[model samples]
Target: MDDCTDRATKRSFLAGLGSLGFIAFGTAAGRTSAATDSQNTDPQPGKGPFTDSDEPEAFVDDVMAERIGTTTPGATVAIVSGDTPSLTKGYGAADVDADVPVRADETVFRGGSVGKLVTFTAVMQGVEQGVLDLDTDVNSYLGDSTVTVPDTYDDPVTLRHLGTHTAGFESTLDPDIVADPAALDSLEALLTNQQPSRIRPPGELVGYSNYGAGLAGHVIAEAHDTTFEEYVQSEIFEPLGMTRSTFAQPVPDDQPGNLAAPHVRDGESFLVADDVYINMRPAGSLSATATDMAAFMSAHLGGGAVGDTRILDAETAETIHSRHHVRHPAVTNWRYGFHEYGNPDANLLGHSGATVKFTSYLLLALDHDIGIFVAYNGNPSEGPKAVVDEIVAEFDLQQAPTTPTPTWRSGGQERAETVAGEYSLTHLPQSGPLQVVDLLEHLTVEPADNGRLRTTILEGDGRQWVETVRVRGGGRARCPGLRGYRWRGGRAEYE
Candidate 1:
């Protein structure tokens, strides 16, 4: 049960998997024919669609071992582009004590909140079928009147709000719910019973709520006259050809050969999850391989058409990526389920998922017909962000910089007066200004190695708020907390 022994067992298991299947859909003739059909069309330059090269799998192994050597017993990773370009790889162990080796396509890691996208898709399908309206009051679909809505809200709670995390419902996955297994028996019970706190009124602000999405799932189940699990399986999973995906609690023991054991950090040790079944099933319960998830993303990147199957219309898929509502005053670019970046040139949309031991991220560029999906079966500290950043850079997938100025500030003396001022964070639209609460009297603005102004905010009481301000396009400075602020127009009001 020691950490080292546990890790070794997991590594051995992941390394012992047998041969894996790789499928190639289009033939040379088919590719040629498709290219010929689009001869008159000019395709834009894209970063990838990258095929896995024979770079020593050593690089990936080093990454996995170094990052999660202490916490995760084993791990796996799979990346895919369009139908033709793909890379499926695995490393580490499925279970440390069991000595199960992780297989690329075979290992089934918890999808976590990635399952929300599945539920979101199902809700959208209900919208398309007229069984559910995005803007309709959810009370109609609920069989019971246990859940209550605030009277101050003029607008009704719609399926759209649930998908976009704007339902204004408080999250019920608190300590009590986590402690009790049966607390998740019904969504209405969880919602109506949980105290109501009006967070910016429904649809006005976007705050992530597992309670809101699970409520939507319950509504969908009632509307279709079937269990939420069954409805999603038949309508979404089966149609998208995700044979391995499911919402079942604890996943079926006899179902698949590649089930990834969940892990958690216990002080200096990483142990298996104690309570795997919590109330966030609708928000985070899902399991699948990269191959299956790629199909889901393929359908999205392919304009809602994966091979011969079309689960959603192109327009509807586009709308899902569109900004429905803003989430936070500080993070204005976040909308609904997707995070919006203000750079007009880089129109990317996607969601990041984190569970007890896994972190997954999926991003797609509608204009470029490009998509990327990443899944890691370890803690977020296992370097998922670095891997994602590298992928984005490698593919050159990001939009062009809006501002042309180099990140470095030119030769200049540290000027406290020049930089000191009240600035508005304007990257994301806001109702009011973001005042710099304290600008140190003896503060200085200096150029960091990266072309940006580093302002040292010092207080007479010895407190400090150091901020790095990067110039984003249109004479706007990108400040971390304050977002994009006007650089020149606003005058400094000294305290």
Candidate 2:
């Protein structure tokens, strides 16, 4: 990866604190983060046949600059292809108070829910080795006669449900773990005390549950007769050659030097959060560098093989990316560990992670064998999805045939300002909030580049309520009500 200091001029964008602030925190089960040496190094170009050239670098620079100005004290981004990383850049200070700058390969941040992917991989390995079965009831492996499912759940919760978060288990870890770093050390006792619920029948619907993942990790530990941390280290990390990755509590002690401090917006400034540990290691407690994560992404993209090492068979890897169940029928595409973007014409699969202060995303183009990993040190007004969409567009890395870019007429700033407002989901009320949505009409907007007259809906509710609606073409905006509902897409709808 190239370490570049050629900074780009900052761009003015939306700003805020907490959920209103640019923090990216997903509630999924696993988490990961880190920092490294800084030396002036040339940007290493992508290994894939297609290269993004200067466009991607410029785009990345703009992103980092925005985060530095808005949320994080420092930020590190690593973009890689196949076996080699293309870009690794750092911006701002790693320690704001100490004024320590972030290094491309050195700075580490929380992994957030990305660690769940690793846990999922570990479970799959056990399944492949005949040590576990995906279809087998999880209670069989738990071997606890005292533990029983609620009578409400007619179907038994299996390993598959647990792995895919369909087991209906709910996480009960103390929320104060963010404030108390040592809380995670007593995870087993906590899990034992707080019996999770089977709110829904197993495999009935996809409801993300950290408890489900932690339970799966627990089951793996029991089946292998070892601590979950040790089992993951021995079976997954070591084999994958992730030298610096670990599930250690009180992070820096486990893997020193390369740790990225967590950041939270304090007033108009960004400050580091107290070092927090997760007792639910399986769901969100792994720390790794961008390079190490790139290796993991490469393995997944390469069908479970990083170079000559085959961590999983091609078939098993394929299973990991495939959609295990429909999460929300109206919510477009939601899959097992990842979500699908685009329709039958084009699709990309990946998952995004966020902690209190950091936002990260990993996207893979399965057909093209291309993948991208992005991690930011601080929060941004825009989420990581914006970064992913921009990179893919700037690089022309879509799996399907390319479509012609549409021409957009710039509507005056007044129109842009008029359309930009927070919108709530009436149908899916629980999906959180959306904010700063800019709507455009009859514009062939490319990814990464913002357009004018674009009526964008900043969903007050974070749920992606509008699916299958054309954002560019002139159609009725089918968005949920509460608006100057200008003509952009089709008429907006509630459900």
Please give the RMSD to the true structure for each candidate, in Å.
13.1, 10.9
In order of listing, the candidates' clash counts read 17, 66
TM agreement with the true structure for every prediction: 0.67, 0.70
The digit string of per-residue lDDT tens for model 1 on 317-341 reads: 7777676764322233443355543
Angstrom error of the Cα, residue 482, model 2: value is 18
Candidate 1: worst-modelled 10 consecutive residues by lDDT: 28-37
Model 2 residue runs over 4 Å out of place are 1-49, 52-55, 144-151, 170-178, 252-254, 327-334, 342-345, 399-495
Instruction: Give the Cα RMSD of candidate 2.
Output: 10.9
Estimate the overall C-alpha local distance difference test score of candidate 2: 0.56
Question: What ranges in model 1 sit over 4 Å off?
Answer: 1-71, 143-145, 171-184, 265-275, 326-336, 341-344, 380-383, 400-495
TM-score of 1: 0.67
lDDT of 2 at 198: 54
